[model samples]
Target: MVRRLPFLLGGIALFLVNALTLSIGFGFGLSGVPAALLIAAPVVLCWYRPMAAWWLALAGLLLLTLLGPVLSDDEALQYRPWLLNAIPAHLAVVYVLALSVRLRIAIPAFVIYLAAGALTPIHLLDDLPNAIAGAIVWAMAVLVAMVLGHNKRVRLTSTLRIAEERGRRLVLEERNRIARELHDMVAHHMSVIAVQTATARYRLPGGVSEEASREFQAINATARESLREMRHLLGVLRDPADPAETEPPPQGLADLPRLMESARRAGTPVRLAVVDTPDPLSPAAALTAYRIVQEALSNVVRHATGAATRVEVAPDETCSALIVEVHNAPPDAPPPAVERPHPGHGLVGMRERVAVHGGDMTAAPTPEGGFIVRATLPLASSTGAGEPSPDVMDGGDGRDTSDDQRIDRR
Candidate 1:
């Protein structure tokens, strides 16, 4: 009700102003009460029905002009040009028509208004200038209203387009982030499993059972198949603008030693340790472990360079899972100057990686004014033959690898 108050007040004001002009015709006794009512009907009806109001106003003006000589008394001839009084009401109606209707209706109504001015016979010789001036004013008002309405529509369309583009950009950014996390957490592990199984099978100790050797071969074959499928999946996820040939392989636990050496050369001292275990980690678990340590050390290098950092990788003694922790001491000096702001998607990516493996992770400030990140990834179960399940092979698909096809020919 409160929101509607302004419209109500505006409609009442329009009716009263049109009523005032109609009252002049009544005072001159040019037409009786009935004709006066007809002239005022459109003004009152315009609030409820604009199109009908336009027709009604035009008809009433024409009716009054045709009947003018008959309705006026001899004394009223002194004010013979009674149609002049209706000029304001007619202009108001034209303005409303242009504002509320489409161009087809509005343009015709304007044309009719000019036609009425020229055809109405009630105009005296002295009233010609006033009639011409009134028509000019009405045309200007209608044109201004149409121009404003067009501009408002264009602005509204432009604003909606901008909002839609912003939404599309946000969706693309989210897809790219998911692709990055998959590359870091899944591809890395698959690469490691393929490399390790191939090397371990040939390096087996003497007198190993033939069945054991077969199982190792099967595991090696499955890992390699999974790696090929992973590459295809990555290709699908990668942006089309990125060249596949230029893309590098994912890094894993095997890359830790080189990463540590590079950090040391960059002036950040670090220590690395891995606990021995008889059973190796699943590809997903190993990749999750590697990413956690990688992101943690990256944080240290960016925010706490020159700090002493320790990276620990080991199997959890209490459960069939791998535990990874990266702890760093406070920086000896302030961080180096940076060229751009960090978007801070690193921690989010770590959590996503851990969650994918049904693992838990935490990154928080330690009591010693340093930062520590810890993650535990539960190892997936293997088949009785010591191989990952067929579903795990090729990452839940039976897609044959081109590499395996080439190997078979060899």
Candidate 2:
């Protein structure tokens, strides 16, 4: 009903004007032409160009004003003043025409109705009813113009909002693409760097200075750690079932032995406990578990340097799930201040991996001291081995057997 209101009002106004002219014995075209122009202003402003429509309305108003005097009765010419009303009507028409274009009003063409109202008193001469009707018509015309201006502003706002949303989506997609490429390229280089460092550290002669050996060892450790971190980040970028694009190596619970051995080499105490030993895990689940443990140990090394840490891995026979946890004492005073949140990336990557598999992970500052990371991974089968278990130290607890200080339970 609201949609058809403008058309209904316009049709009634035209009918009234036509009936008045017909009853008064005026020419049909003379009254009907101006009434039609007033009716059309509302509809034309809705779709037509503001400037063009306003200019056309101005031209029509000028022609109508001139035609009005030439064709109308020289009604009791002494008492009647036609030009006073005609001039203001003409000026009002011109003012509104330009204002419609500048303000982007919807009723660009109909504004001439206001001019017609102003001129009505000139012809009616002290007729109270017609004067009151003319005033009402002018008020309605201004009201319509205000509505149109508001509507135009709303439409522009909606269009701008849609454009902004599209731009933001495009930016997010580009960032994901760049992150994938960087992960693959950087991981490959870091792996190679690690291998070369290990070779140099082993083959270097006794004549080599202690400073040189220490530098080589530091580079080797740093490169290997960087490679692991890159692979974890790459895992976050991998889409589901994208075979053409292979994921970074699968790291899981099986990787714990190697993790402990590395920590032992760095002279850090790490205890491990493996409870229910079940068959190997699914590739995806295995990789998730591996990353959780890897990131947990990495955090301990970076934040709790020289602090004692314990790792516990248990398989719930009833639930067919694996639980792995890492806990350590807090650093001496204020935690080893990170230059940035780079170290937090490992924990974030771990959480992302676990969530994909409908698994759960928790990492936060411990109430006692230090930080703790605990993760639960679901297993498919118990009796049958799905994937080959990587070579594990298989000491009492997957920890290195050499000393009680470090252990690897596989």
Candidate 3:
């Protein structure tokens, strides 16, 4: 309704002018109502079907020209080409015509309408000064309407193009980020494969044949070559300005105690619990879980300061997946602008991370007026195996908050 307000208002204004023209009758008896509808309906309909409404407006002009208004008032008879009260109504149709068509169509349409308007006067030279002056005024009206409409069309098209380009760029950047993360995860496993193959002869209980040893050497070389290709690919995905190669590796599940401790220091009361298992998470899953919790905690601190927050990580009922959840209670007293809502950029990134690993996640406001986010990442030996079991750190700010930590219960 809000979007249609301008059109609705314009329709009513034009309708009223046509209504006044009908009330005066001006020589056509009961037939003027059809002419009035032809002039007025176009104002409302032109938004959806400009060309059709333009034809209707033209028909109304033709009707007025054929049955010229026979009025006693000399001043009123002067605007016969427009039928006096219909000028505004007809001008609106021309404006919309400019908006609806290309420059070739709009420019030629304006010329045809202006020429027709000038030629349609019942008596062209009876009042020479008024005739010349009316032509200038009418030409200006038509010219301004088309110019404004054409510029408006160009401006709207540019804005739509800009939005589309921005969306495409954001999508490409996100794909690169996901690619870098996968490369880092796969590179770790490939390095392990190379190491294991290199040591097979020494580690195996039974002595291997010379042929078996050669096969092991071949596997090691292949793994190393694959790692090199991935590294080259990672370089391509990374930005030239990024110093990420020198930065410390990103934190994973093992870093959560420290994360919770920082949230605690930020004035959010927080607790964590980790259920240990013999099976370990793929580096990608651990990092993604760690990021989800980190972002959830950050949002709690920003939007619900002093909220009691809990972070939990454990296997689901069947033990085939890891379930990580973060829940925050409502704040006691939010800071200025803290409660103001924002677009959830953090949640979107977390969802993308989970999606890349074929996981499902949900983030929504809680009935308690806080927020909760839960992610389920599938697990299997083929997906993730040799990473060490996560152990709680004495949370660097170096105080051991044993009461707040989950002692890895195997």
Best-performing candidate as measured by lDDT: 3
What RMSD, rounded to one decimal, does every model reach?
Answer: 16.2, 19.4, 7.9
Q: Estimate candidate 2's RMSD in Å.
A: 19.4
Q: Against the true structure, whose TM-score is highest? A: 3
Q: Which stretches of candidate 3 lie over 4 Å from their true place?
A: 1-3, 25-34, 70-84, 122-125, 243-281, 289-410
Query: TM per model?
Result: 0.40, 0.35, 0.69
Task: Give the clash count for each candidate.
Answer: 0, 12, 0
Off by over 4 Å in 2: 1-48, 62-66, 72-123, 126-128, 201-410
Better of 1 and 3 by TM-score: 3
Q: Alpha carbon lDDT of residue 378, candidate 2? A: 74
**What does the lDDT come to for candidate 2?**
0.54
Q: Which ten residues in a row have the lowest lDDT in candidate 2?
A: 401-410
Q: Residues 278-384, candidate 1: write the lDDT tens digits.
A: 25556456656766666676677767778888888866655477778888998888887655332334565677778777889888889999888898887774222
